[model samples]
Target chain A: MEEILQLVVFGIVIGSIIGLGSMGLTLSYGITKFANFAHGDIMSLAMYIAYFIVVDLGLMGPTVFSLSFGWGMFLAIAVTIILLAIFSIAIDKLIYKKLRRDKSNIVTMAIASLGVGIIIRAVVTMFWGPFARNFVPGIHEAVPITGNILIKPDQIFIIALTIVVTIVMYYLLYHTKLGKAMRATADNPDLAAVSGININNILAYTWAITGALTAVAGIMLGIQAQVYINLGFNLLLPMFAAVILGGIGNPWGALIGGFVVAISSEVSTAWIATGYKPAVPFVILIIMLIVRPRGIFGSNI
Target chain B: MDFLIIENSYLLLTATGVMNWFVGFLTTFAIFAIMALALNIQWGFTGIFNFGVVSFFMVGAYTSALFTIGPPGEYENYIMGFELPILFGWFAAMITSGIVALLIGLPTLRLQRDFLAIATIGIAAILRAVALSTEGFVNRARGMNGIPRILGDVVSGPDYKWVLLAITLTTLVIVYLLVEKITASPWGRVLRSIRENEETTKSVGKDTVNYRMQAFVLGAMIMGLGGAIWAHRMTSIDPEAFNDLFGTFLIWTMVMVGGNGSNKGAVMGAFLCCTFWFGFPLIQESLPDILGNKVFQLREISIGVLIILFLLYKPNGVIPEKPKISRHL
Candidate 1:
């Protein structure tokens, strides 16, 4: 019973991370029409930014509301998201825009995204020297929820944060005018353009929101697992599995898909070896592909 | 007179050593050239974006190594412990990887364009994950070592490398001719047509899936052969050795830099990349520890930057893919 609860708690945290990280990928795929391989690296970049702020800037000494990090990490996260959004736009303008102008195929853009990822990975290694770094120095003790159930304060913080973010995101998607415009644009770009929607504005918003969401995922992952050069790249597969499992281009589907992948991966460890946990989602994905090519809630685009 | 004589002998020895390094460099180039050719058949000829080259290559290496290497003895325990013929091992590698490709390609081919890349990357990771964790398969983490060399016993030392070079180059020439022949055939035209526009080709009655599957399997077979050659050269095998940068990304860059649609361009790009990929290790030995490692990593960055720059600046590559004459024209 204890192990199951522990795994479930861990699963939720991981699921939220996947959900947040993959929100950007699915959004970009919907609006931009290609998977940004560099998004994973961008997440890594965000996590590193947070780490640098916490460690290098001496935000390491304080505690806030039972969490190890303080205001500096929060400030760093804000800065990271803004900078990452701007960076995404710059990359689009510099690299992808040319391909778009030339009417290049999706494969070209995808490969270009890979190139972008490689460049970032190289930059990270060059700067950080290819070693793993931790955000907080030591391990935090878990508090008992009951006789059998114990969870960390950070874990609770993560769950609450995820829920708050999800509510805000849901409200933004359903209630806000800009959100409707974004949704309309994603549904039918040609029609949206015909309807006089500012496609460029939507694209920019998409980039910014995607960057922000990707950042959150990266930071959360860093908190759970140590931040390394390959942090984002390693998650790339599972994130993709989630996106595809939910059906590409559907954000809500991606949210659900994230939980599916996270839970399955965590649960399967009882039978499958721990090292092969990553493979569990992959097997699920392949089976999903065979049974339902478009995914559960995904409409074939 | 004694000092002068010593200097002359040192210069002579250095010359011989550098010549040996050059020979080894050429051999590395040949193996990469085979991979470039295989990738060309897939991406260049058929436009099937395959990012799982490393997985197939690893499979090939292990399969062939398993076929030929003697029993694991006391230290290592592995499946199919036998000492088969060299040619048989190489053949077995191709067949094994080819079948692996076919099984994976069946359901995935019908998906959207980049999904293939995503799916293949997943598949490759799963493969690596399994290889790492499974105790029964290839002895898990320690990896199979001390595999018998292909022609290590018969030809030896400096002169034997020349024999190895001759053999490697001969294979390259044969693969080049075979690929050229296939690309020149009408069937090749059909494949190119699909690349130009899959839906249109399908409308015109070509079995696009079959052709793609063919390209994928054939290319995988070639990659396997490349892996087999690599294992033999190293006299060992490891899951880590067949990494993306070394196996998939590097070869893709080679094809991209060389000219994806052009066979000769693929071969040309392989030689150029091999110069950087292999040449650096030799130079690294001469440099200070930290500096050498940094320079080594810079190569990866350069490849990444190169892909972006090329895509932005030179999409057709160093040797531009010649526009095929359409039958309608």
Candidate 2:
């Protein structure tokens, strides 16, 4: 029972990380109407950008609150989020904007994003040299909350951060005019345009927000694991699984789906070899596609 | 006279080496051409989004090897060494791939296009995970080796390379003609209709889903055939060799560059892309250390850039699909 509980905790930690990534993915998909294969690589790019700030820039400050990374890492993450938002907007202007003007299908956009993903990965590899590195380069100690229920302070921080981000996301989507505009555009681009909502502007804002979310997810992933070139690419499937599971365009669905996927995959480790953990989410994804293509929450933006 | 004779001998040897290299190049080209043609059927003609091309390729390779590798020795710890002929293995490969495709496509083909893409990516990842983790199934990380080579008993050395090249080219030609023929038929027209508009096709009483499933399975089977040929040529199999980037995305690039919906374009794309992909590495050797060290990465970036540029500038590719004209025209 304790072992199962421990596994569940681990699952939830991983789930939150996946949840964050999926929310960004779902947001992008909601507005763009195409699955952004590059979203994972965006996360990877964010990680590298943060790594540059904290490590390459020599900004390693003291570790905070039993966490593995320092204030420098936090600063790096903030800067990366802002930079990534700008980057996403720039990319939209450069690549997706042209495609959108051409009125290409969603599959074409998806493939283009796949190409973007490849380029991003290659850039990451070129800069980082395909090696694993940590922000602070030390094993985070796991503090036991109960019998055999040990959790890392870093893990707790990740969960708390995810919850806070979720709340903020909720507020933004519900309370903000930009968010309303974004949702309206996602619901019906033709209608939105006819109604005098600037589709392009909403798209730009969507990219920025999704970019910010992707960066946070990437940093959290790096903190949980280690920063590596394939870090984001590896998370691609799980994130997609979560997004599809939650509902393609629905942010809340993605958040919930992330936890569902992560927990299922993590817990399946007890029965199967640890290496096959990736398969669990895939199975869930396939089954979900077969049974209910709309996903658990349905595809509302 | 002695000096002249020596020079002639050296020239002869060099000629033979070049011939060997050319043959080897064409052999692999034919293999990829076959797979690209397979992809052309799925994505180009049928409009099926199959991102997991590598899964069927891997399955075909492993299946053929398992069927033809014969019995394992004590402690070898592998299963299903049927000791069958290579021909049987090839058939088995195609059938297995088709079945796998049917299983996956049955549900997803009826859904939105995005579902098929998502499902394929998932399947590819799952298959890879399975192949890597299951020690008893595929010999784990060490990979399956010592499979019997195609025509090993009769052929040797340089002659064997030529023979294998002949076999692959023959298979490629057969497949090209087969798909070409089917795609020109009424059945193919139905597929094209579905690709153009599924709802319209359904309204016309054409079973769009069934047609898609057939195209999907057939394409997967052809990919399997290509994989079986690849496995036989190498006489070994490994999970790492079937990386999605190489086996899947590169094929996609080939199909797109060659121009989808054109059989000749697929072959041409395979030829062009393979030459750059394989031949560029040789050029990398002569490059300065700084550039040479990152040649592979640079090539990857170039390919990505090429894909984006093509999508933007020349969406239809070098040889865009020709509109079907009336027979009188």
Q: Choose the strongest candidate by DockQ.
A: 2
The estimated TM-scores of all candidates read 0.94, 0.95
Q: After best superposition, candidate 1 residue A250: deviation in angstroms?
A: 2.1
Q: What's the lDDT for all of these models?
A: 0.82, 0.87
lDDT of 1 at A100: 85
Regions of model 1 farther than 4 Å from truth: A299-301, B1-13, B280-293, B326-329
* Chain A TM-score of each candidate structure, as shown: 0.95, 0.98
Error of 2 at A156 (Å): 1.3
Tens digits of per-residue lDDT for model 1 on A189-211? Answer: 99999999999888888887888
- RMSD to the hidden true structure, all candidates: 4.3, 4.4
Error of 2 at A208 (Å): 0.7
Question: Chain B vs. true chain B: TM-score for each candidate?
Answer: 0.92, 0.93
Residues B127-177, candidate 1: write the lDDT tens digits. 887788887778777888887776878978668878888888888999999
